[model samples]
Target: MNRTYLTNIDTSISDVDFTQHKNAVFILHDQLNLDTWPSWIREEKPLLIFIESAAKGKTLPYHKKKLVYLLSSMRHFAIECAEAGFPVYYHSTKQHYDRALKDILSQYEDLHFTFMTPSEWDSRERLRTVISEFSTKVEEIPNNFFLADAEEYKERVKDGWLMEYFYREMRRKTGYLMDGEQPEGGEWNYDEQNREKLPKDHSVPSIAETETDEITREVIEMVEKWYSGHFGESEDFTYAVTRRQALYRLNEFIDERLDEFGPYEDAMAQGKYDLFHSQLSVYLNNGLILPKEACDKAEEAYKNGNARLNSVEGFIRQIIGWREYIRVYYEAMMPEVREANHFDFTNKIPEMYWSGETKMNCMSECLKPVIEQGYSHHIPRLMVLSNFSNLTETDPRELNRWFHLAYVDAYEWVVLPNVLGMSTFADGGVLASKPYVSSGNYINKMSDYCKHCDYKISKKTGEDACPFNYLYWNFIDKQRETFSKNGRANFMVNMFDKKSNEDKKAIFESSADFLEEISRYKKEQ
Candidate 1:
C-alpha cells in the first residue's frame, strides 16, 4: 500500500489518495521551456501538465490578443510535447488552478507532484496554496531562465543600486562583447549612437508576420466568445505561437533588422509602428525565445559583419542588461513595491487612454498601434503614455493597471517595476534616478508629431499650446520638494524657479484649465 501524507499548511486543503505513480510536474505560463524541467524529474519522465484556468482570465481582465496568444501557444506546446513522446496533459477548463490540480491528482492515486518556481510572486503564493491541498509531496525547482541570478544582483546592488553598474557587471559575467575587461568599443553603452531620429523619407523595415494555424484560429474564436468585453481585438492574430516560429523570427531579425535597430531604436514616426525593432518582447516574455538566445543572435550578427558594433551592442544590452535587471529588481522589491505611490496621485485615468479621442497627435499615434495589435516600442511607453501620466499626476497604480491590462508582453514581474519604478516613478526614486517627463520640444525633436498636431509646440500657455509644455512645468512645480533634492532633476527645478512670476502664473492657470477639461473627458469618451 502506497502512503500519501497531506500537510495542512494553510487554509487550502487536499484529499487523501493512494497511487503507484510517484511523480508529475506542472509548468506555469511564463516557464514554457524544457530546459527548466528539473534533472531529478527528467530521470522520472513525469507527467507534464499545463492548466488553462479561470484564475488568469478573470484576474484584472487581460487583453484579448494577449489571452489568445498564451492559450494558443500552450496548446501548440502541448502538441509538441506529445509528439516528442512526453506524457502531456493539457487541461482547458473554466475553474481555479487548485481544481485543475485536483482533477489531475484524481487521475492517478498517490502521485507526488512537482513544479518549477514561478516568475511572479502572486502565482508563487497561489501555487503554495494549491500544493497544500494535495496529499502527495510537491517539489519546487529553481528557475534558471534569467541571465542574472538573484545573488548576482544582491552582490552588485549594495551601494546605490544603479542600473549602469549592474549592467556592466552582466557584460563582464556574460562576456558577450568583452575585450579584456573592457566593453567591445571601450564604452559600456552605445545609447548615444542609438538616438538618431528616423530621417525623412526613410523606409522602415517590415516585420515578420506569422501565419495563423488551426490552433491560433481556435484560440481567436475562444477569446472572442469568452472575453467579449476585454480591451483588445482577437481577430487576425499574428504572433508566433511555437518555439520554432519564434526562433525563425529571431534569425530573420538578426539577418534583416539588427543593423538599423541601433540607430533608430528611440525614433517614433507618424505612421511607422515599428521602424527597426525586432518586436520579439512578446516571444521573449512567453519563453518561446530566451534572453540568452536573443543576445547571442545579435552578437552573432556583429561577429559575422552583418550588423554594426553599436547596433549589436545596443540590442544585446536590452536583453541581457535592462531586461535581466528589471526582472531582478521586480523580484527584490515586491508586495510593498506593487503599491508604492510616492507622489500620492489620486486622479482617475483619463478616458483618452481607452478611446484615443484626443487632439494630441503624439498620444493618439501611440494609442493607434497599442489598440490595433496590443503592442508598441519603448519610447512611446516612456515618452508618450507614461510621460503623460507622470506629468498629469495620474495615479501610478492606475497607470500600472492599464499597462498590465494593455500589453501582450506584460507579466507582473516585468510590468510592475517598469511602471512603479521606471515608468511612473511610483516607487519614488528606487528604480529611476530621476523622473522621465519631457516637454513637447523633446517629442517634436524626436518625431514629426508637432508638425501635424492642432496645438503649437512653441506656445507654453493657453489651450492652443501643447499640453506637454504646461503639464511638464506643472509637474516640476507640484513636485518641487520631491524633485529639488535629486541632482539629476534639481537643474530643471532651478529653471522653473528662474521663470518670472507672471509667466509661472499663466503656465499654472493653463494647466488647471486643461486638467479641468480632462476631468470632464470621461463623458466625451
Candidate 2:
C-alpha cells in the first residue's frame, strides 16, 4: 500500500491513498510560454491551472485595451495547451486568486501544487502567504521569462550600478555586439546617430492589422462589459494575441521599419502615432516573445545588410541593455522605493492628461494617441507627458499610478522606476543623472507642434508665452540646490542666475498663474 501524507499536519486525515496523481502546475498570466517549463513538468503533463480573477482586474482602473489583450492572449494560450494534450483546469471566477486556489486545494486529497515564482513583488508576497498555509503541498520554481538571471545581474553589477556599465557587461556576456572583448564598431552606443528629426512630409509605412479570432472577439466583448468605465477604447485593438502573430510583427518590423528606426527615433509628428517603433513591448513584457529571439532576428537583419548598424545596435540596446537594466533596478529598489519623494510634490496630475483638452499642442498631440488607443512611443512619453508633469509639480505617486493605469504595456515593475525615478525625479536622481526637464525650444526644434500651438514658443514670460518656458525656469529657481550638485544640469542654474530680476519675477508670476489655473480645473463629476 502506498502511504499518503497529509498536505497540512492534521491527525484526523490518515486514510488517503497516494497512488492517485494529484500533482498540478499553476500558470500565471505573464508566464505564457510553454517552452520555459521544466522538462519533467512537460513530460509528466500534469494538470495545468489558470485563473482569471475578477478581483485582479478591479485593482486599478486599467486601460480597456490592456485588459482585452491579457485576457484574449491567456485564453488562447490555454486553448493551445489543451490541444497539446494537457489536462487543463481553468477558473474564470469573481473570487481572488487565494480564495480560488484554496478551494482547489481543499477539494483534492494531498494535492501537490507547483508554480513558477511570480514576477511581481506584491504577487510574490501573496504567494508566500499561501505557501505558508499549505506547507508541504506547494512548491515554486525559478522564473525563466527574462533573458538575464538574477544571479547574472548580481554577479555582473558590483560598482556604482550605472546602466552603461551593466549594459556593456551584458554585451560582453551575451556576445551580441562584441568584437572580441570590445563593442562592435569600436563603440558601445550608437545613440548619437539616432537623434535625427523626421523630415517634413515623410511617408511612414502603414501599420499591419491582425485579424481577430473568435476567442479574441469574445474577450473584447467581455472587457467592454466588465470595464465600461476604463480609460481607452477596445474597438481599435490590433495587438497580437499569440506567439505566431508576435513573431510576424517582429519580422514585419525588421523588414520595413528597422532601417529608419535609428535616425528618427527621437522625432515626434502630428498624426503619426508609432512612427518607426517596433510596438512589441506589449508582447515582450507579457512573455509572448523572448528578448533573445527578438535581438537575434535584429542582429541577423544587420548582418544581411537589410538594416544599418546604428538601427540594429540601438534596437538591441533596448532589449539586452535598457530593458534588462530597468528590471534589475526595479528588483534592487522596491517596497521602499515606491514611497520615495525627493522633491515632496503633493499636487494632483493635470486634468488634461485624461481629457486631452490642453492648449499646448505637444501635450495634446502626444496625449491623443494615448487616450484613443492606449499607445505612444517613448519620446512622447518622456518629453511631453512626463515633462509636463514634472513642470506642474504633480505628485510622483499620482503620476506613477496614472502611467500604470493608462498604458497598455505598463506593469508595476517598469512603471514605478520609470516614473518616480527617471521621469519625475522623485528618488533624488537614483536612476537619472538629472531631471529630464526642458523648455519649449527643445520641443520646437524636435517637432512641428510649436507651429500649431496657440501660445508663442519664443516668449519666455508673458500672457502668450509657452507654459513650459516659464515653468521650467521657475522649477530651476526653486530647485537650484538639486541641480547645483549635478554636473550635467548645473549650467541651467547658472543661466537662471544670469537672468535679470525683472525677468525672474515675470517667470515666477507666469508659472504661479498657470499652476493655479490647472489646480482649479476640477474634473467634471
Candidate 3:
C-alpha cells in the first residue's frame, strides 16, 4: 500500500497578484496556536499558512502519536483562524521548508512573510536564507513564548554557566519568589525534601486528557496508514491539542499534583507510570501554554498559601530555570554540540532499546512508557535511559536521535542539550558537571520495580546481579582519567580506587560479558 495523505485546501496559483495576498503568516507545526500573536499580526489579517511538511515527517520517522498530535493540533488551529475571519491556506506535501516556501512564494507574488523565529537552529537559518532570495521584507518576531527572553538569558549567563546559578538569576529576574533581595523560605533549593519515594498508600491524581475530536481521528487514521512502522502506539492518542485543553490540564496539575510534585519528583515506580509529575511538557514545548504563565500560576498558588513554597519553588525552577536554561545553552553551542562526543563512544544501540525487551526491570520499565505513550518523566530519562547509555558507552548521537523520534515534546533545541550534554556528558561538562550514573541501589531506593526484577539488586557480580552495578564500575574505570578531573566525580572515583583489584576485575569481566550478551542478542534479533 503505497499511499500518501496530503492536506489540500481550496486555493489557486494561476495569475495570482500580490496586491490582495501580500501579507502572509507562516505557522510551523510546533507553533500551532495564535495566543502570542502581535497586534500587527492580527491587524494585517494575513493568510494563516498551515503546512503539513513531509520533510518534517522524514526527519526522524517520528512516533505516529506525535505526528497525529501536531497535525491534529494544526488542523484545529486552522479552523479557529478561519472562524476568526482570517484567510487560511492549509497545505500538505512531500517537501521540506525551503521547497514549500518557494512553492508558496511562486503561487503568491510580491508576498512578505511574517513568522515567529523557528526554535531550531537549522530551520531558522534555512528560513532566513530562503526569504533573503526573494528580496522581500521578512518580519521575524521575537519568540515571547518563553519566560526569559534571549536578551535576559544573555545578561544573566554572563555571571556563570551553572544551572543553579542560572536558576537563581531567573528567580531574581522574574521576581518569582523574591522578598525584595531574599528568596522565599530563605532557601534557594528545596530539592533536599523532594527526593522521597512514594508511600505505598499514596494515590496519583488523574491526568486531564484531551478528547480526540473528528479532526484528530482523521490525523490518527492518516498516521496509522502512512506511518505504520513508526516508534510509538497511535491507538490511545489523548494529548491536549488546543489552548482550552492545555489550560485545563495546567490548572488540574496545580490543584491536584503540585503539592506532591516537590517531594517524590525524582521517585520512579512500577505501574505508577507518571506518578505526580505534571505532564505539561507536551503542551509547554508547543505553543499551547507559555512558561511565564505556568510559573506565575504556581507562584500565585504559593502566595495564596494554596501550595507549599517547596513545591512552588521546585515547579518554578523547572519552568523558568531548567527549561529556559537548556534553550539558552542550545543556542550558545549548537552545530558543534550536535557532534560533541567527548568519550568518542562508537557502540551500536542495542535492539532492546527499540523493542523494549530487556531482562533489566529498570530499563524495561523506562522504555515501556516511551514505547506505549511517548512519555516518561525526567528521572527515567536521566537515571535510567541515559544512565544505561552512558555506562554502556552507547553513541550519544544515537541516543539523541532515539529521544527526538520517541518523544512527543522533543524539538531539536530541547533534545540536543539534554541528550548530548546532560544525559551523556558528551560535551565534557558543558551542561552537566558530572555524569548521572547510578547503580541498582539508586534505582532500588527510588522504585519498587527492583523488588520484582530478575536480577538481584544486592548482588555485585554474576548473572543474577543487576547490570547497572557492574556497568557503573565499568564506566568509571573506563573513563577514570577523564572523570577524575571533575570535583563532583572525584569522591566516586576515589571509592572505586579503594576497591580490591580482584573486585574491580570481576566488575569489568561482568560488564564485558553483558556487552557480549547484548551483542549476541542484537545478532539474534
Top-TM-score candidate index = 3
Per-residue lDDT of candidate 2, residues 375-423 (tens digit):
8998888888998898998888888988998898888878887888788
Measured with C-alpha atoms, the lDDT of residue 256 in candidate 1 is 85
Give one digit per residue, the lDDT tens place, for model 3 in 1-525.
122443322311122234678788888877765767788767777777777776668678688788888887777777777777787777777777767877778766778788888889878887787768765656777775776676656544433478898888888888999999899889998999999999886888879667887777878888887678678899888898778888999999999899889998999988778888888899888888888779889989988888888888889998888999988888778677789898999887777778899888888999998888899999999999999988888989888988998898899989998998888988888778888888888999998889879999999988899999999988888898777898878778899999999999899899999988785113321
Say which prediction, candidate 1 or candidate 2, comes out ahead on TM-score: 2
Task: For model 2, state the Cα shift of residue 511 in Å.
Answer: 0.3
Q: Which portions of model 2 show Cα errors greater than 4 Å?
A: 1-21, 151-160, 519-525
Model 1, span 1-525: residue lDDT tens: 011110111112222232534667788777777865667655666677777775578787678889888888877776776667667656556676767777666676667788877888878887777677763566677777888887667544423488887888889999999999989989998888989999999977687788998767767776777788778688778888899999998998898889999999999999998889988999888789888888888888888899999999888888887888888888788778888999999887777888777999999999988877889999999988999988877898888988888898899888898888998888888778888899998899889988889999999998799999999999999999878999878988899999999989999999998887784123310
Error of 3 at 482 (Å): 2.1
Highest-scoring model, lDDT: 2
* Per-candidate TM-score against the hidden true structure: 0.93, 0.94, 0.94
Candidate 1, position 455, lDDT: 94
> Clashing pairs in model 3?
none
Instruction: For model 2, give the 10-residue run with minimal summed lDDT.
Output: 1-10
Q: Candidate 1, 3: how far from true, in Å?
A: 34
Count of residue pairs whose backbone atoms collide, per candidate: 4, 0, 0
Cα displacement (angstroms), candidate 2, residue 517, comes to: 0.2
Candidate 1's displacement at residue 472, Å, is 0.4
